[model samples]
Target: MRLPEHFLNNRKLESLVENQSSFTLDHAAMHIFETHQQAEQVLLQFDQPVLASMIEGKKVMHLRDYESFQFLPGESLVLPSGELMCIDFPEAEYENPTRCLAMAISEEKITKVLDWMNETMPKTGGLHWGLMDYNFHFVNDAAVFQILQRLVFLFTEDHPYKDYFVDNMLRELIIRILQTNELKIYGSDTFTLRENSRLAHVVRYIRTHLHESLDIATLSKEACMSASHFHRVFKNELGISPVEFINNERVKLAVSLLQNPEISIKEVYMCCGFESRSYFNRVFKHKQQITPGDYQRLLQRSMF
Candidate 1:
């Protein structure tokens, strides 16, 4: 997502490389960085966990365990405390600067939220609420994108009760981020399922039967629980409802199918168990910020 034009216009031309403007709240601090002119091997480190979101232009990120990769707009990276970053700017210029927002959050704040979550809404299969200790880079999902946009506004604007608003937002942001991370792990082909756990059995069932009509009653049977209880437990454990999880799985399968040039969009939706074209488009667009057809076209252009 793009930053407000007013914020961009008011930036001071202090440095040609990685210019910084800072804003602070009680539990976190946000720094807006703008870089002009090509730069290489620029080092950055944080004392607290930092969430970095790209706003404009591009960067080549060199981090542990990951090969150098392009950091583009609508992408984000999460780094743990004291993690070092080496960044490269191949396309920075006076007229075309690379802009990014880095938000550093306190460890205590994170710990408090994690403790509360584990106590009140414990995850299934003995999983605990926590953040990844290593660097995590991902495309901005719709929920994350919306939260980041609101956070930027809250941090940049002047308000007497700024910390109160931001603190609440930060709690949600943390929960959403953890939920996204868990979804990635659970949805991965390599993630092993513990056969004894109810959630594992239900997840396995859902994955295998995605092409069929899935209802809560059927899924609850897989978990050996009633439909109402299963729904509540699933949402509590995963931070998403059973229906949402099903739709997410369907959309993910649709994405994989769409990559094949031989697969028509209709075929993709049908294979993913979508009842109609319009419903598929709406669900896919909501998650990915683009219609299935548009996404496929963009994919084709990139490949060719």
Candidate 2:
């Protein structure tokens, strides 16, 4: 994946604080910012998947095509790449005005870490422990918060070995995230059955083939189940029917494609696996509650 040109230009730098008070990190990284200034819809674009955690103050984190989460001092929120997030701060201010950190993790690095842990940690059965759903909150322990504080200090301070320290600390931070076991939703079951596993396989397949025609019968066959049964089980497992899930995934791809001015809407429609422009528009508007042109305009407004 081609990262932004600025990212390539600042590869060697550990941290950059822009005039807008947002910080950027180049490594398995987190951008930390603290400000009392009221933000007018702060939107961030990540080249890699990112986890944004609010270490201080109450803030609202909203993600497109996912869920929204409210973070207190000790809570953290996770966001995937190509996801647009809106952060809103409380109107009444006390001690601070939205101090948060955005951590970016390379997909390749995460895969390698998961593979290593799968081989080394027999109990996990090759499952990636750091996998988090969009907009979910994980309460941080004291140790984790301390590590984050140290990282912030290292990032802000001009120490001689800042890069070395930051890299080692980031590795440790990933280990902490892997070891965390506080993931749960109220009144939700945590077990997986054979049927649910099949549904998960279907979801993974859809994600992998976002640019291809996703027929229900083909997907059902891929899951080794009848179409009716697959639809029922998939809806039960993922809280959405298979077809809805596919359309949602396509809309997500469409939003990403719309970010590029070079790609025409027609080209984006075909590239994102829409059969026709009208169908794409219909689905996009139905999901986003706005037409693709309006969505692009919103993004452009945010850019300025």
Q: Which has the greatest lDDT?
A: 1
Candidate 1 lDDT tens digits, 46-84: 899999999999999999778989999998889998888
- Residue-level lDDT of model 2, residues 1-304, one tens digit each, is 1123443344343322111223434466656555464554566677787766665566666767656666677776666687776766654243334556777777876676656654554221123344545555577766678777777666666667787787677766665665453213211234342444555566667777878899989999988879887776554334346777788778988998999866788888988888998999999999888998888888888989
RMSD of 2: 16.6
Each prediction's whole-model lDDT (CA): 0.87, 0.64
Model 1 residue runs over 4 Å out of place are 2-6, 9-11, 255-270, 276-304
**Model 2 misses residue 293 by how many Å?**
58
| Residue 227 C-alpha lDDT in model 1 | 91
Per-model TM-score, in order, reads 0.86, 0.49
Clashing pairs in 2: none
